[model samples]
Target: MAGEPQPSGAPTKGGWITFPFLIATMAGLAVASGGWVSNIIVYLINEFNIKSVDAAQIANIINGCVSMFPILGAILADSFFGSFTIISASSLISLAGIVLLTLTAVIDSLKPAPCENGSTLCMGPSKTQLGILYTSLALSSIGVAGTRFTLATMGADQFDNPKHQGVFFNWHFFTMYAGTVVSMVGFVYMEDNVGWGLGYGLCVAANLIGLAIFVAGKRYYRLMKPQSSPFTRLAYVIVAALRKRKVLLSSKSEDYWQETQAEGTKFVRTTPTNSFKFLDHAALIIHGDTNSDGSIKKQWNLCTLQQVEDLKTLFRISPLWSTGILLSTPIAIQISLTVLQVLAMDRHLGPTFQIPAGTMMVFVMLSSSISLAIIDRFLLPTFQKLTGTSATPLQLIGVGHALNVLSMAISALVESKRLETARSYNLNGNSIVPLSVFWMVPQLVTVGVGEAFHLPGNVSLYYQEFPKSLKSTAAAMVSMYIGIAFYLGTAIIDFLQKTTRWLPNGINDGRMNNVYWVLTLIALINFGYYLICTWLYEYQNVERKELSKSSPYPC
Candidate 1:
């Protein structure tokens, strides 16, 4: 009890230390796997003699599912399994998958033989040889998605005390980016030279090492117990909605929609409340409990359903945040699509001077890293001074979305130039795009702008929307939205590719510039939607009060 968090298993200094280590491990494994995965596309295309777009789509489809699978993990974590167990177990599952993937590289499928040199895990002769490869990828994705939310909440448990809360968040984001930096550079080079098997093997090793670190500090983690399934509450909501619908249509149901006038979350009615009173779902913006001296104090009180329901609550108040997920969908493309655009199309330099396609990731990494650092070093303080408190995270979100919109337009036009150049010349070998690569700098820079806005806002928003106990689940909710959008984005792209003739049959011959132009148009629409939702995004209570003091009202 002495070391345990107040509401959970005993907290110890060890748990806190172990908690971050596990998280960092997770971060390293996730991003590093991603780095290798990106390079793997080049290997698959070269090794198998597949088309470029085919390789791109294969990568896209597999990763697209990563975001959506977390919901299953969240559901189980919220109900049957606690965070610690799920994370550890999932990591083990993923580690197995990684081993199988490495084996594929050495073992040959044809004639029960191996690769030219005869290895154990190398692929077989046909496209079917990749089936096991895909399975391994799926397993890793499952492990990652399942444990992602489980561990994040586990980490937040360390800083529930208000004093360390702000610092905890700042460090959390920092550690995440730090893990990303290491993986991006280290994994890419390894995957490029060694076969896919060894590169993937390294990723498994990273995850396992992180898991081992997590085990050492397990005593300090302050793991919370699981709760009842959220489906029950969702069922409750459905019944309530149905009952309300009947009442509304029958002209007697308005009372059903009213807030439980008593403050308790759930209360059954003997009968509908009124002859004339209409339920106001939007009204009664639930006020906080006040102390005897007029100060406000916060309490976290809820069940599994209540915790999960908070996502709906978050959506209600921060409609923009939910829609903001769509705006962010392009980001998943940062590694795959944007990389393709730069390497395959950008025409700024001649063949001799063109940057190696893989090197383009440096720009993406630079944008995310430098932009985040600048925000902390300069941008945050400058905004704090100028807007006082009113310039909130939501305000930054609007600015970020604006940048996303701008970048899309730039990519459409500049990338188009590269395509035009290639089409005009008969040169097939060592073909490079034209003046468009220079324009990538601005688009890439804007990626940083978008990151600075969305990352903090999403984190803070998820944390603020839920009670402290359910913070992890809330984080899952945020991630799930992104995941769903990601899966949807890939499916949409695939459907378009097959249904449309815009893409030529050759591997390197995608109408990439046209594709980006269409995406640019979509970004503008997403920007408009984000703008509409901006009025609803909120800041955390502490930040809100501090900002309230400013002379002008902005947030």
Candidate 2:
């Protein structure tokens, strides 16, 4: 039985057959995560009696935490446990967090009483209550960070062909967006109309179901075992380079350490390129650095040429990564403020139904989901045909920046219009302004379209350009950018609030349009910085492949 193939109809290790299970798990987790996060501002303001601005700030900080922690999760996945184990364990943690969050909604003692209608003063939550709430949020945020990008890497692992991986990535975003749409619209509606407890209870159920489905499909996964930590090697390279800093440089490739076959693997190592020549010293087989079999005699004294180059590659790419942080900060601020904008505007569809403030984010998700398909299927192909080449990732990101700048301008104009309407009505004291919430849609849609370009573009660029040792880390790099952006945006907002009257407790009395204008100026400057970085950068892998295939021209 051990040697035999058993049954003709038995399931295989990995194939298209695993798609349904993977997608179902993704959807369930997305719904669960979105259910809590999409409505957090409203939940805090209404149920916990927090100020609107303060609630948005908390939401941004939480978002930053969720995005940033993924780097640690990815490191753990690539260096120790594989993605499946991390995903399973993190789902359980998230489920526990959701259960606690649901308890806060259900138990009267967990939250302060609701503010009376038309009353400005409300009791703040006690330290004990705030402590429990924050603990629950921290758990869920950590849980989300563990699973988000890790699942994409796992699904990509199932496919050997790069084309198949590309297709899977598209479906990953699609499923994520679809789930977010459901949670933002349906779950948010439940929270606004029925009760927060029921909505959060559904989140708990979704997390449980997602975890179960993932566990059930364990046999079908193509799990990658963790090797020694890549970060450890990167650190070794830096240390070795500094130690050999006084040594003379060499132009010859033969002087550096490269494997005929990489240790413990059969694949031949590629020759080191000429870039970042200073790092070549790390691989120089200087006196007392290596043993008889060419093994390193001292861990901190010698590293392979590939490892040094890997560190250099990260250094070269970092400026580009920093650009994304600046690009995303404005978007983060816009997202947080847009919810508050919705609260102050007319949300009616007709006489019977009104849009929930949280549900408006569904437009961004919907735009991204639909726009992704169009870009992948139609836009990119058309550009490739007309230009006789595929658009590079940098080019795609450039387009995204242009779109984002446009979105910011529109946001400023729309806010100005809303504020003008408020002044005309002399309704500065009223909670609801006369402006339609739908006016906010153009900016959201534009931001979504920009995301459709930049997000996948960054993922593809990192995956293609990063050294083979750091694939999972590459995916998390995108998360790191967004995380820093959120936190930085929080700092900027707090700073502005403390220094100026542009953002007070209420928006109607504040110059929100000026904030948008400031964001627009920052975005434009960041775009210029990105252009310089992209212009100076070379694609290491792509350039080498092109060079190897090129023939010398005859005189």
Candidate 3:
């Protein structure tokens, strides 16, 4: 298979493909990326002399960029270059960013001088210095987005079997979470105890190594050819549907345009589903819509019924996807706030060992990792056995919502207790509360459990439900939700700061309990909305099964 004819960079269709190379690259990149990102808030505050809340906001913005660009990456992979080219290029970009970040740590001139003790005034980074920092963040964030989700598609491309694909996805997530844990614990500890220079230098090395390993396995990867943009087809369907809005939809399948190779050959045709009947107009054949040979006359003004229905399918699933944004927003808020809480609480495990504030998120990642295994191995199978049917994605999402609401309540309670402890200890200003940081673990674990249920469920649902042509976009939708949520979290924090005194620079002064209460209410409301949407939604693949069983076309 390796000797078979193929393009210069692409491997043959059949061979021992290098999926492990992709996985290893993903793991290394994940570690390097997570190391910097997880501790960015602390770095900005301690080194760059930014305010705590401002640093958190900046971190959220960076996270938003990282999450958002994957859609663009997916589009580029599907329409222009394949995943291999994109990943290679993005990895190089990331390495450059990490190198720049390393410079800020190594060179004292690149950063503002450390604040003097008992000084109220501290100098922030100069505009030029900030520009350099922001540039590095932009490059690294975009680079991470490009490689992370796209690699999932590339790895799955290596396998022909659905079972193999499922296994790959499981391991992909496992490696991702494990890498995150390593960065959050080991790398963050190094940054806190040793030096930022050493920590960031390690990140640069990891990225370079990941890139080198990826490039070395060039001949062992199964590459997919780029196709024409599916977005264009979707646009044509919309334009055609609007142009033919008054055209009556026919019950007979013959009236709709089905694909044919030539005059005498016909393709296996699917009848448009009864849902979204208005979109069916796009497929209704008008006298001037097609050529004599049955090709489209005006590319933008005419489309097949299948094309129109494909657009409708996207429309159907959109509300459900929007629910994920709401689901993630509170989780984002929790992560940032949890870090802030750790900063203000007793993080010491013993007389000597103290946990880094940035590393508190380890609880969430740890809980999520374990929950993933339990959900896959025990919970899902038991549920299926009890019900005599596998739980639908919607049901899994509903479970997640319940757990999130509970988690928010727990967060509120913990904060309330912490606030009481602060008050009791006379810790009014710049003093850590006497409360133990372990109080945050339960809420973090709860949210992690919610993530374990909904993250995979949402990804699986989108991948299964989206049109075959839009599979890359489907995978990217999850990233879109997370990106939007991070931005939304930032906005929510800003809003609270402006409107209320719930989130001051110091956690000791701020009424964080109220913020958690607000999030809990919102999560509950969002859950209700999700439930209504779930009730209203119907699966779109029934027609495909029916079409496969019996042809709509007459002989």
| Best-fitting candidate, scored by lDDT | 2
lDDT of 3 by residue, 332-407 (tens): 8888888778888898999989999888888888888789778777887787678666666667778999999999
RMSD, one per candidate, in order: 8.0, 4.8, 4.7
lDDT of 1 by residue, 237-276 (tens): 4443333333322233322223234675576433332322
What C-alpha lDDT, on a 0 to 100 scale, does residue 278 get in candidate 2?
A: 77
Residues 473-543 of candidate 2 have per-residue lDDT tens digits of 76688889999999999999999999988888788889999999999999999999999999898887556
Give each model's whole-structure lDDT: 0.57, 0.85, 0.84
lDDT of the structure predicted as candidate 2: 0.85
How accurate locally is residue 268 in candidate 2, as Cα lDDT from 0 to 100?
50
Once fitted onto the true fold, the runs of candidate 2 whose alpha carbons sit more than 4 angstroms away are 1-12, 250-254, 262-275, 544-555
After the best TM-score superposition of candidate 3, give how far the Cα of residue 407 lies from its true spot, in angstroms. Answer: 0.7
Cα displacement (angstroms), candidate 3, residue 477, comes to 1.4
Give model 3 RMSD, 1 decimal.
4.7
State the weakest 10-residue window (summed lDDT) of model 2.
546-555
Flag clash pairs in model 2.
none
